[model samples]
Target: MTKKVRSVRPDTSFKETALALIQNRLSGVPVVDRQGRLVGIVSESDLLPREALDDDLLASAQAFFEGTFDWDSLFKNRKAVALTAGELMTTPVQTATPHTLLRQVAKRLSESGLRVLPVVDHGKVVGMVTRHDVLKVYCASDADTLCNVKDALEHRGYVPPRHCIDASVHEGIVTLGGTTIDPEGLRRALALVRAMDGVVAIRNLVRVDSSAG
Candidate 1:
């Protein structure tokens, strides 16, 4: 997720939004309220000359309007806005949470046909997750995944002793094996691993350390 997100105000004019998108080379941007809460999203698609937009918007707007688009996947938020971004932007947009797994993000994008998904926390935009961002996980090597898994377990206080736990990755499939005296810790550990961005699957072979009582 991109924490430093670019956004627009609801009152922004069409031309202003278009120029910002063009100069920044942004395909789309989120619409934020006074408190920076996500109200809607504006993508290149919003600028396109649909039956809704006038002819003058074709060239400059085309580079944007005809070019890129962003908004709710179902267009349920679609309304008629001639010149302002407030009415033009799409609303009720699909979103993801900070803890959302990359796999889940990928699935949402694929199912919804959205170019970007906003990361929202408590009605505020925290970050932006693009298709490119989700795809980057596939580029990660197994070594990287193992390192992350190890790092995660180390930071967790609920997990078993780090030295007693073993993790191995093969082609992004992670296997966890060891003995843990804390059943709850093992449960948490498995959940942490399952959410890793690069993890394709998780196989747990850990046993309970019954002797530790």
Candidate 2:
């Protein structure tokens, strides 16, 4: 999650929001209160049409048949008009919590067709998560994943000679081999590997020894 996020206040003008988005190269910005709680979100799509224009009425069958449409004129008019972020932003914003799992966050973004999600904690805005952020998990290098897994195992005292666990990573998948006298230790090691960043899957080829202590 990106802890430092660019945002707007409810009363921020639409022109300012658009300028900020263009400057920051972002598609949208979260609307927060003075106390920093997410209230809504403003995107380029929301600001495309004139806020004062009644889109539902203008797009009606009768209006369309009348041939009174002028796309360029309408788009230009919207930009010429000044509106506040609260007037143009979308409400009931979707968000993620700090404790939310990465997979779950990815699912939410996918289902909502949104490129960014605000990370909230205790009803306050904390950070931002983008589609790029989640994609990085799958793009992790095999060598880095292997090193991370090894470090995690070593931290838990589950490395070779101590627990007889051998690890190798290929294409983001980790394969564990060798012999372990303790079944629970093997389970813990597998769990660690599964939780490691960039690990696509796990192949547990470990041979468990029940008699050896």
Candidate 3:
């Protein structure tokens, strides 16, 4: 299952938005319109402080501060609080579909240097995808783990008992059945399943081979 989404409106003030992000411990916020359409996103990178001053201004300010400039008066003359979301927001945002596989999404996030991706549906924004969400959901989501296990076993000289041993995956559970050489072989097969990634459980019914010629 995926996570629920939280978003903010485009008209939200940068001051308020920054405060919200800080309070939630979030790196950024998705900016949406009144119809819930994704307009842009604002991140900490967007809120970077501007250059302290131009060359001439910096020299004068440095000389004054070193000499007799009052800290309170000079600070009051500076303007840093005027930044806004509209001025700092990143536009033409990248997005992800909800049905997108988590592995692919994680790769996109890493390659794009983006911490979050807005989840869209039919060109409309529906939710958001964050790095944390990608890690939690994709790491836990079921993949072709059973196939991996079977392939590993085949590579490790663990030959299945002819047509006796079979393997399959369903809903993160690895199902192993059919006869093997002995109880130890069956245990080895189960261990293969256990070692696989994304395998939530193993259902083993492989009987110990006791066939008599």
Candidate 4:
């Protein structure tokens, strides 16, 4: 999630809104009211319904030779028909909160087809999360996950030593095989690995047997 959320006011003109998206390299911007309440959202998709004159594109060569290319005017005509952010923005905007789980945000972004989801606090935008942000967390390699798991165990100072533990990772799945008399230790280890990034599943073959090493 980003700490600084860029937004546009409801009365903001379409030209200003387009500049904001272009200058910031953002696909969308949240619309906020005077009281800082999220009223709607504007996205590139929302602005695509109104297209530019095809004749302008066809005359590109002629315009170039005549030095009559007015990009500002041409793009202005291409912008969405609605002149204000309020008119062009989509209402009932999809959003997340500071407390929303990362998985939930990922799910929303995936299923809802949103490029950027605003993170709100009591209807006011505080931050934003993008699909790229979620990808960064979940895209770790299997080797990295394995290394992270081993490091976690080492930092905890395992009592019986790590030699007795058999751990291997494949496709983000962790397989645990060892003998542990302490169920609490097994539980703790499993929980630790499960919470780790890129760990998709765990095969717990650890046995709680006093006679086993």
Top candidate when judged by lDDT against the true structure: 2
Name the better of 2 and 4 by TM-score: 2
Ranking by TM-score: 2, 4, 1, 3
For residues 184-205, what per-residue lDDT tens digits would candidate 2 score against the true structure?
Answer: 9889889878876688999999
Pick the TM-score winner: 2
Worst 10 residues of 1 by lDDT: 71-80
**What lDDT would candidate 2 get against the real structure?**
0.81
Better of 3 and 4 by TM-score: 4
Q: Any idea what lDDT model 1 has?
A: 0.78
Pitting candidate 1 against candidate 4, the one with the higher TM-score is: 4
Q: Give per-candidate clash totals.
A: 9, 0, 0, 0
Structural RMSD, model 1: 8.2
Better model by lDDT: candidate 2 vs candidate 3: 2
The runs of at least 3 residues in candidate 2 whose Cα sits more than 4 Å from the true structure, single-residue gaps closed, are 1-4, 48-58, 61-83, 96-104, 120-127
For candidate 4, which ten residues in a row score worst on lDDT?
Answer: 157-166
> What pairs collide in candidate 3?
none
Rank candidates, lDDT, best first: 2, 4, 1, 3
- lDDT tens digits by residue: candidate 1, 60-85: 45555665643342253244344777
Q: How large is the C-alpha RMSD of every model relative to the true structure?
A: 8.2, 5.6, 10.5, 8.9
Residue 203's lDDT in candidate 1: 89
lDDT of 4 by residue, 1-213 (tens): 776656899999988988876765667888999999999888998777556435556675578789988777655554445788988888898899998877788888898788989899987899878988877865788889888888887786432474355678988898988777777778888888887767889999887886654
TM-score of 2: 0.73
